[model samples]
Target: MAFTPPKETYTGKVYTLEIGVPPDTVRFGGENVLPLHGFEGIVPSRPVIAYEIQDIPPDDWPDTVKKPFKDVSDDPVSWAKFCRDALKARAIALRLIGTHPDRENRSPEDAAKTVRDILSAIDVPLIILGSNHTEKDASVLIAAAEAAKDKNCIIGKAQEANYKTVAAAAMANNHKLIAMSELDINLSKQLNILITQMGFDKERIITDPMCSALGYGIEYTYSVMERIRLAALLQNDATMQQPMLGDIGMYVWKAKETQARPEDVPPWGSLEERGIAWEAVTAIALIIAGAELLVMRHPKAIEAVEKVVDELI
Candidate 1:
């Protein structure tokens, strides 16, 4: 008699989404198995990684991550083009951090113009991100959605404070919306419900249950994401079935492990390699936990995760 491996069957599947105009679009999700467990069920798409850029120069970014794009970083268009043409990015996420009231306080129109310029410069999918200011994002993302209309972008980060307005913009412009909540599975599901209740199609939503670096409550983040995935796959919960996003770069790059100088922390070795490893490890953990889309910085970190994804699939 031949020995047989036990395979678990899941009833639910993640919604498949396509971003960017056709011929240049990327698709993800539509998997029914646990992450990387393709042998157990259908796994039509591997995870997608988007290189993170910004409307303004990445001045706040640490030297290690910022050095790579030093020449083009000053101009958003040039920065976006460099990522697409030189870095071979699959997708680009333009974070409108300059629009924050405390930052440059750029007007919505300024953000819209930046969106148009970057859209014109790059054919790959674009993910338009606000500066995580709940109030500012409501207005900024609305303008950005209009500017990128019909180009098929992903407009995000509709949190509890501003999901209605942001979700409306995404709905009006026909772009995907990323519904984010704190690191709680219940909150994530509740936010999704609220968005869909507004007549935004649930299938077009992506769940961002927030993100954390490796040593900074990453285990909690991982647990929430895994439970969400399990709820979707095992319990067949429709509210939890949307694909997840791990905004890896922002969180990973901020951690002390990524920012500390080797001289200051002699045991950590090179700062650059340490930063890259921090990002890669964080991203890989989320991917295993059920993140179908990742927004990451550091070419080497993205490269490392990409290689791992290839091997896993």
Candidate 2:
């Protein structure tokens, strides 16, 4: 008798939802709905890539990293074009960072005009970012939502701190909204629940669970996102089911792995190389853990992450 391995059970494919499902088309003017879990449908909308555009020059960014965009960074519209034309950015994220109180505190009307300029300049999907300050984002995102109302854009980051105004604006204007929370699973679900309770369509909501750099509590972030996605796909948790977003560039660029100076530590190699690696790796990690969309900076980092995405999808 030929040696035989112990009989083991074989089960049909369990249908692991490695890929997200794009939401059903709601026919909201020129915009398309993005789905997270395959339960929504087929096609995950190719995991949207939103190229970051700052309302003001990113003076806070290190010189090594900011040098690439120094030329076009002078103009927000031109910067948006560079991302679309040169970088081949599938989506654009325009941040009105200039409206912060310490900054120009530019009026909401001015920000709306800038939105018009950017909307006219590019055809790809647009994402409007508030200055991250609770008060400023509430006002600025409102203006952005109105300006790009029919053109089909995404306005974010409705948080517990400012969800009332932000959610109202995005819902009124028929734009997708990102419900953001600190790096906690419960908070993420809670925020999504609150936003939907406000009469926002469930399909139009995206979840931002907050991102952490490579070494800075990344494991916790990963676990939180992993649990969220699993609950959505397996347990069919409505609040956690919305597609998740990883603001990779923002956190990675601020971490020690990306900010370490060569002068201070000779062991660390080139700053450019380290920074790119940190961003690329962190983004890939998020995808593995079920991030359906990402907001990133740096051309090289984008290229690297795109390659990984292509292979996985």
Candidate 3:
């Protein structure tokens, strides 16, 4: 006798979003089942990973995470082009770390110039990020959105404090928005709803439910992302259906496990290997937890996650 395999049927679907223009666009989401649950339902596109670059040199990043791009990190345009040309990055995440009030305090105009330069240097979709300063982001992203106008970029990180301003800028410039919240399903859903309430199209929004490194509240982020995906697939929750973003490198490279020297933490083994594994593990876990888009640093880590995604899908 032959036995039948049990499969879960999903009642809802996630939206597919496209970024960049023809011949260079990338897409994700549009699945009717959970991540890689091919037997359960339809899975349209594989998850995408965007290599992370910065408008200024990543001075605060540990050497292990900084070595790969040491040659091109000095200029945002060179950095972005290297990711696209040499690294063969499908997407590039350009972070305006220099604009932070505590950092270089770069003017909005300077940010805009950087955005334009990067946009011209690469053809892949650009994920424009601010320095995580809410007040500063409100202004910086406006300039960024305008600079990348008609380029089909993703401008983001519209949190609760400044969602209105940021969402309006994204909407006005016709770019996708990233709605971020602390690692809480309820908060993530609320922020998405709020962004939509302000007349931003829900389909154009990406959700960032915050990111934590391995061994550092990562399980909490995992649980929240799982709940969000379940809500989207099982309960048919519209607000939770946006493709999730795992901003991997920032959190992973900063963790002690990734930065500690083998001499200082002898049991941890090679610091370089530990750092890459830490980032790759965190990224893979988030993907399993339902992330459809990932922003990561370190080419080896991104390559490993891409292999995992290939095997899963």
Who wins the lDDT comparison?
A: 1
Overall lDDT per candidate, in order of appearance: 0.94, 0.76, 0.91
Task: Show the lowest summed lDDT stretch of 10 residues, model 1.
Answer: 117-126
Q: Show where candidate 3 strays beyond 4 Å.
A: none
Error of 1 at 89 (Å): 0.6
**In model 3, where is the ten-residue run with the lowest total lDDT?**
117-126
Model 1 per-residue lDDT tens digits across residues 65-87 = 99999999999999989989999
lDDT preference between candidates 1 and 2, better one: 1
Q: Give the clash count for each candidate.
A: 0, 1, 0
Tell me each candidate's TM-score: 0.99, 0.85, 0.98
How do the candidates rank by TM-score, highest first?
1, 3, 2
Instruction: Give lDDT for model 2.
Output: 0.76
Kindly give the stretch of ten consecutive residues in candidate 2 with the minimal lDDT sum: 12-21
Q: Once model 3 is optimally superposed onto the true structure by TM-score, how far is the C-alpha of residue 250 displaced, in angstroms?
A: 0.3
**Which is the better candidate, 1 or 3, if ranked by lDDT?**
1
Model 1 steric clash pairs: none
